[model samples]
Structure formats: C-alpha cells, structure tokens
Target: MKLYQTYASPFPTRVRLLIYAKGLEVEIIEPPGFHASTEAKGDYLKINPIGRVPTLVLDDGRAIPESEVICEYLEDAFPEPSLRPADPWGRARMRLLSRMCDFYVVMAMVPLFNLSGRSRRHWTPEAIEAAAGKVAEALGWLEDYIGEDGFAVGGALSQADGAIVPQLVLAVEWIPSLFGTLDPLPRLPKLSAYWRAIQTDSICARLIGETRDAIAGVAAQAKAQAATSGG
Candidate 1:
C-alpha cells in the first residue's frame, strides 16, 4: 500500500502513528503538491479527490481518504498488536477521545490558520482570543476523559493516543506562537502528564520528533522564500 502524507499535518500523522505501531509495510510519499491549491488539481486529485493528506491506496487500487477512516481500515486489515481496546466500553472510550480530537480540538485550531506564518496580517485580538478559548475548552474536555496512566484511553497505546498526540502537539506550538499565549497543555493536568509520559513510548517519541521537525522545516522554508521575494 502507498500512503501519501505530509509529516506536518496532524491528520496523516495519526495514521502514521498507527502504521508505525503495527509495523505495517506501507510506502510513504508526498502528494503532487504539498499546498492546498496545488492538491486540487493533477494526479493526486484523481486518486483521492478530496485533496487531503494521508490517502491510502491499496494494492487492488482502492483509495481511502480521511485519517480516522484510514486508521480504522488499517486496524481492521492488521489486527495483531491492535491499537484498539479489546472490550466494548473501552473501545467506546477510545472513539470518544478520537472524536473530541477530530471535531472539537481540530475545529478550534482551524481559525488560527489565518494568523499563521506571513498570514499574521489577518490577526485580530478577537480572533486570537476566540481560537485560544475554544481550544482551551477542548483541552479541558480531553483532560476529563484522558487516562492518567499516560495513554489516552487504556493501559497501553491505542487509537486514541494516535489521535491525541499529533493534534495536541500542534496546538501546543501553534497557539503560543500565534498569540503569545501560555502552552495549553500545562493548563490541563492529565493531558500535560500524558504529553510527557507518552513520549517515552518509542513509536510516539519518533513520530513526535518527526512532526516537530517537519513543522520547523516548513517554517524555515517559508521564511527563506519570503526573504527571497522581499516580502
């Protein structure tokens, strides 16, 4: 299988976490263009049509889009070393954490994109405050559900950890850099603890390092491009 992903994107990072945990033999590649506008055209759109990262193409030529759905497919296809809980309630808890990450947490981060990089010209106090507040609320919701044992759901790493890790990591850097706010994690104790504890897991540590490096790489490239263009 071929998985198209960009390391900086939280969505694809979640799927990559699962792939690493399961030791799946999937080829990872970047899409036609790493930018949104570039993704809307050409060969990549033909494959997934959504113009999104982390599209999984099976050997039979079937395409799967959306990170959460892709994670579910991988779990089903490769069940050993399962990332899901064994029981019903446990599975439900995992789903709940994933849902919060996707719906509430990711949604909160969306508005801040306008204020990102050279786009800070769009920043407004109201906009920044609103985004920060929304994310803080989302973090509180996560703290209520996240296990204190370092994993997001069960005693061990699960799909919930995959969902939580990348998004929270992005939130930690994005919010403070954009608005001079405190790192959001420290405000939520369970999540803050999980953030520190989960990194000790080898797969989580590697993926987190990749995500940070990719984000920094993108920022450096953007800065260099801006300098060249005299922006």
Candidate 2:
C-alpha cells in the first residue's frame, strides 16, 4: 500500500498517525510538483483524479481518497490495533467528535494557517480575528464531547483523538502568534487536559514532534522568502 502525503499538512498527518498505530507498512509519497487539477497533471493524477493529499493506493491498484475514508478503511482492514470504540453508540460519538473537529475547528483554522508568518501589512486584522472566533466557537462545542482528564473518547486513542489533536495543536500555537494575548487552551479545561494527557503516549509524541519540526521548516522557508522579497 502507498499513501500520498505532505509532511506539514495536518490532514495527511492524521492518516500517518493511524498508520503508525496499526504498524502498517504503507509507502508514503509526497505530491509531484502539481496536482491533476492543475493544467499539467502529475503522476499522482492517474490514481487520484481529485489530486488531493492523503490518497491511499491499495495493493490491487485501487486508490482511496480523503483522510477520514482512508482511516475508516484502515480500521476495517487492520483491526488488531483498534482505533474505534467497541460499541455502536460509542462509535457514533467518536464520529461526531471527529466531524465537529473537521467541520467546525479545522475549516475555520484553514484561513489562519499562514497568518503568523506574514506581515500584518499583508493581512487584515478582521480576517485573523474572524477565523480565530470560529475556532473558539467550535472549540466550545468540542468541550461537551471530551472528559475532564483522559483521551478524546476514553483511555484508548480512538479516531476522535486522531482527528481533533491536530486542530488543537494549531490553535494552541497560532492563537498567540496572530492575536496578541488570546489563548484557546486555558479557556477549555477538558480539552487542555486532554492535550497534556496524550503527550505521554509514544505515538502521539513521536508524530507530534515530527509535525513540529515540519512546521518549523515551513516557518523558516517563509522567513527566507520574506527576507529575499524585502531585499
């Protein structure tokens, strides 16, 4: 099996974490310069027409797109390291948590991704606040789903935890950079404790460390570009 991914991308990172959990030996590939959507279609286009990241190509040559779908496939295909809850209702709640993280938290956070690296002169103050506001609002909803001091679903790291942690990482880091003093974690106790608890897990810690390094590389690249442009 082969998986297409970009190191710093949060969505693809989710799949990477899942792969790590199952100890699956899937080949991970980065996108070739351009996607199928562009005028010039790259090799990745042949398998995934949509040309999105995190497309999983199975052994028989069938390609699976979307982070969530790929993870579901992994769950069904590799059940040994179970990421979903045992009961049906528990599964639904996990899905609900993931859904909220994707639609509510992630969608809002997307706009703010590059805000920290760019000069304030390049972006509107209102735009930054608007996106942050969406995050805070959606995070309030997420608070209802988590416990006071455990994993996203419980002691085990389920799909819900995989889906939500990346978004929280973004908010925890970016909010202070974009807004002078605004912080998300302190306001959300359960969510904050969840972040602290998960850090001790080897899988979470390892992947999160890799992500931080990737994010740092991106910031350095942005700084170099800005310096060159200013010169």
Candidate 3:
C-alpha cells in the first residue's frame, strides 16, 4: 500500500499517526508533484481527482480518498493494535468525536484563515472574536464528551485522539487565549489534563513535531520568496 500524505495537513497527519502507531507497512510519499502546487498533473491526480493529501492507493489499484475512511480501512485491514473500540456504541461515540473535529472544531478556524487571505477586507476584529467564541464552544463540546480516563475514548489511543490532537495543537497556536488567561493551558479541566497526557505518547508527539517542521518549512519558503522578489 502507498499513502500520499503531508504533515502540514491535519487530515493526513492524523492518518500518518494511525499508520505509524499501528506499525503498518505502508509506503508514504510526498514529492513536489504530489503537493498542492503541482496538483494540476500527477500520478496522484490520476488516482485521486480531488488532488488532496492522504490518498491511499491499494496494491490492486483501489483508491481511498477521505482520511476518516482510510483510517477505517486500516482498522479492518490491520486489526492488531486497533485504534477503535470493540463495542458497537463505543465505536459510535469515537466516530462522533472525530467527526466533530471536522464539522465543528476546525470549521471555526476556517474563517480566520480566509479573513487573512482572500477576504481580509470583509472580515473585522469583531468577526474574528465571534469565530473565537465559536471555537471555544466547540472545544467545550469536545471536553464534555471526552472519556473519563483522559484519552479521547479511554486509557488507550483511539482514532479520536489521532484525529483530534493535531487540530487541538492548531487551535492553541492560532488562538492563544484559548489556553487560559494566567497560564497557557487548556480552559477546561479534562482538556487541560488530556493535553498533558497525550504528550507522553511518542507517536502523538512525533506527529505534532512533523506539523511544526512543516510550518517552519513554509515560513522559510515565504522568506526566500520575499527576499527574491523584494516584497
């Protein structure tokens, strides 16, 4: 199996975390052509028309596009050291929390990125403040649903942790106030404790490190471009 992924993206990074944590024997690739800049033409585009990262192409030429589905496929294909809970409802709850990261949590950050990019003039500080409020609400929802033992689902690392923690890192970086007023910590008790707990998990720390590296790489490229263009 070959996985086209990049650590810069939360979706693909989560997928990579799953692959690594499970000790799966999949080949990972991220050539320049596989990146968004060269999305117009590539072997990646032939398999995944969307030209998105985290596309998994099977040995028999089967392509799985979405990260959530790709993780699910991995669970079924390589059941040992499973990231999913065995019980039916436990599985459903796990899925619910992961989906919330997509539809609720990260969705709040979309407006901020857009405001700085294409629609800067249209957005104001007031709009950003409102979006930050929404992000807080979404974080509250996750905190409420967090398992009692501190991990997303329990004492073990599930798909929820793989999917959610990368986004949480972005959340704290983008909105520093979410960390709290006096100390840079998660607002809620469960969230605060969970944040500290996941750090000891080497796989989570490694994936988060990948995100930081990718961020630094983008900054270096931007600096080089600005110097060359005298911008």
The best candidate in terms of TM-score: 1
| Clash tally for model 3 | 0
Please list the residue runs of candidate 2 whose C-alpha ends up more than 4 Å from where it truly belongs after superposition.
33-41, 114-119, 178-181
Compared with the true structure, what per-residue lDDT tens digits does model 1 show for residues 1-231? 999888888888889888898889999988656732223346988887878788999999999999989999999999988999999999999999999998999898887754665455567778888888898999899999999887987789998988888887778875687478778776788888999999999988888898888877777776676667675
TM-score ranking of the models: 1, 2, 3
Model 2 per-residue lDDT tens digits across residues 30-74: 776431112354687887888777799899989999999999999
Clashes of 1: 0
Error of 2 at 208 (Å): 1.3
lDDT (10s digit) by residue, model 3, range 94-147: 999999998998898777545533323565668767777777788888888887
- How does model 2 score by TM-score? 0.88
Clashing residue pairs in candidate 3, if any?
none
TM-score of 1: 0.93
TM-score of each: 0.93, 0.88, 0.85
RMSD of each: 1.9, 3.0, 3.4
